[model samples]
Target: MQRQPIAEAVREDIVNGKELVFVDFDHTLLACNSSELFIAACKPSWLVACIDLVVRRLIPWKLTHVPHWYRLRDYACCALIVLLCPWNVMLWKRGAPDLFRRHESRELAVSLRACDPTRLVIVSFGLQWIIRALLSESSWRDTPLVATPNLAGPAYFSSGKLDIVRAHYPDEVIARAACISDSLDDQDILHAVGKGVLIEPQGDVYRAEEHLYLPLRYTAAAKYARSYVLDQFLFVDVLIVIAATSFGFSTLWQACLFVPPLMLSLMCVYELGYFENDMVAARKEVAPTLTAKVERYRTYPIGFGAWAWALVLGLLGVLLGWHFGALRSETLLVSAACWLAVLAVVRAVFFAYNGTATRWRAFFYPVLQLLKYGSPFVLILASLPGAVLVLSQIMLMWCSYLIYRAGGNNKAFNRDVLRLMMFGLGGVCLAASFRSAPVEGFFPYAITAAWACARVFKAPIMRACKTLRSRPARRSETAL
Candidate 1:
């Protein structure tokens, strides 16, 4: 029998009032079978392999000769053996290069995301724990899955899939639903549905028929460039760099000469830091919460090598800028070294206290943000001819204004406003003081004064805002 295309099968089912779509897990929705990956993660043992071999051999004989509903003893035995292994050992092995590879079919994941979650079901003979773990971060996290349980019952393959379907839906509903699978063993469930879609091993769509044949169209999202430019925050970094250059009163020529190399160097440096952080977290037996998508699997040694490459690229960019006379090479080197030293100290502190209290972490959060978002521009200004010294103060004022606008709570907003007001006054003082003293002499004074004002009035300003907001609410309640 010639198989129809997947799109045609799906349309027929939907037209027939079938809302539910049952998809097989292994080669159907995922790039590879997760069970195989799990087995491969374990240390090779001929004894274990032979045991699994016996189990596989017995599965068919027992299922065919015994009652269809009879418990799959061999399958249960295999699952117990696999799941009982030490989780730590398995995780360590999983980190090995190319040892256990499992990637989902992005095309299928996107296609299913378009459908209602409640209308999707995953039925497979693979281990349920492995399947669930893999889907934890995916769009299908909450979708219903009926696979071979860790320990129990008949295997969820062939006739077993139909059995599970009947348990979940009415006979009429099952008749209207569509089941998608690649294995010929899925024939029983496929025939039970209104329409069926058979996917080839290479992810091509095919008609649900006896033999797999022919190629179809391929679809995949742009992964590499998108991951860096958008997902890794490089786009926002470029915008910030350009905006700062404009604000610093730099000419268009200067901006054109410096922006690309500056952006490239910063992007590489920041990504290197993130890669190193992730590897450190992984080694500490903690999965990193904040990691770049591209550096998800990077190990510490790999990250170190990448960081070295980034340093080289950044140095090359600096050399080119110096050759163009856009910056003083000696000043740039000194300033960058100072900034890098500061960053290294912060990172060392962070790693030393990897599991510090939330309050302590929160205290350092603003400082970290300033380092990550503001340091590059400051270092660049040190080498280039810009009012960088003065503009740094103005940048603080602008950032405070932005914070005021975005502060969710009224008290926070008022506090931010007060900080901005202090910044404005400090800027005025600096402009006046610059005439009497050198910029170097007055710059420290302005920063010191601004810091003193914020420290002194921070609590009082926040308290006043809170009191003001409460008065109106209290008055409304009194009137009621």
Candidate 2:
């Protein structure tokens, strides 16, 4: 979505394989409005108020940081965020049914990965957790992520964002190429880049003072995106493929007696590798010092060991069927269900370790985690983290997701999601313990009830949550 001369300039750098800085998220790089869609998914009420405030000029991006504007920002933001909305769910994913209505805003992330992977870099201002999680699974992982740090107290990172960039990379330095935002808030960071491009929306104009103004006609950009992919886009296509293939295989196997279930389970687990949603990437801004650190840890192994586990599961599933009651439709279904539970466990471990959380997603996440863990681990084969993981997942789905549908707060990972996930874990145990059909059906329900009870019993917002909060710490501005 980089308009006119800026797009042409950046594209030239990308094609030439010259070093360049790519700074954009929404419209310019991404095709969808990631932020608005995410906010709509959870906190629909707050979405309108925030956007309306921006339109009404109740809050302004601080170019000069006038006292009134700061005060207005504080008040408007406070009132708008009566409750903090978690950014974890806002990821740039590849596959999921698009039955839901999508939203549009200035937030875009996928565009960066799609347009140019080699020379392009992300320069955005999204939260670090959301940004990192999205980029970890991205083709753009090779590129650096230089974004505005989180601002949630010592536990969060914010303020001195541009200052930190400058201390690392001085303005006098020449970058191969650069793109800057038109937001007055981006002036400092923009000025630091070599060839800053100003992104002015329709009807908004700024008189140039320090840099050249790059006017991108909005209508032209939109028209271009209709036929062509944006520069940084990465997902959506692959996700559609994943969803279609999985759904198709599931339906095809619906009538089959043995292999279909395992195939479906494999696909579900495979989906875990596709990460969460996101809007923008961190701003690289043509600063090597800034870009270097961001690139180092961008790609975290997604669904860590999904493929290996799926293979092992397939082998075991075939072996079990061939040796025992291979023809039993019930056996295949149960095995598939068990694998589903395993996939959920895999995701649970990811959430525990990486702090990744997705609403309703946690239901299926645990088994995925278990599959990944139990696949290569000889220890799991011996004791069956496989069984334990599956039981735990079912316990959670029946107990947590089905029971306490509206309870967990994602904005802050409290004990609710924990207890809910545990319900799944416990369900797995209970189901395994009881072989009877009546008990199996009831166990999930019972687990759901327990999760709900726990949710109701515990403090809605577990004040003492977040391990990072316990120790007093200081982050020097020079932190990468």
Any runs in candidate 1 off by more than 4 Å, and if so which?
5-18, 44-77, 88-102, 155-158, 202-480
**Tens-place lDDT digits, model 1, residues 30-76:** 76655555543443332344445455434565546544422353455
Score every model by TM-score: 0.36, 0.29
The Cα local distance difference test for each model comes to 0.51, 0.39
Clashes of 1: 2
In candidate 1 the C-alpha lDDT for residue 402 amounts to 49
**Residue 336 CA error for candidate 2 (Å)?**
49
lDDT of 2 by residue, 1-480 (tens): 343443444344444544455555433443332233232233333243344345324434575454334433433343344345443244223211131112111233332333455556565544433345444544455576665444533211234335444444555542445654534555555565666665543221111110110111111122124222321111212111122122223322321333333443343343333221210111211221122222222332223334444545555654554444332344555555555565556545544433333344455544554453233221112112223333443443344443443565433544346544564566567558666653223333533344335553445444455445776788988999
Task: Go through the candidates in order and give the C-alpha RMSD of each one to the true structure.
Answer: 20.3, 22.3
lDDT for predicted candidate 1 compared with the true structure: 0.51
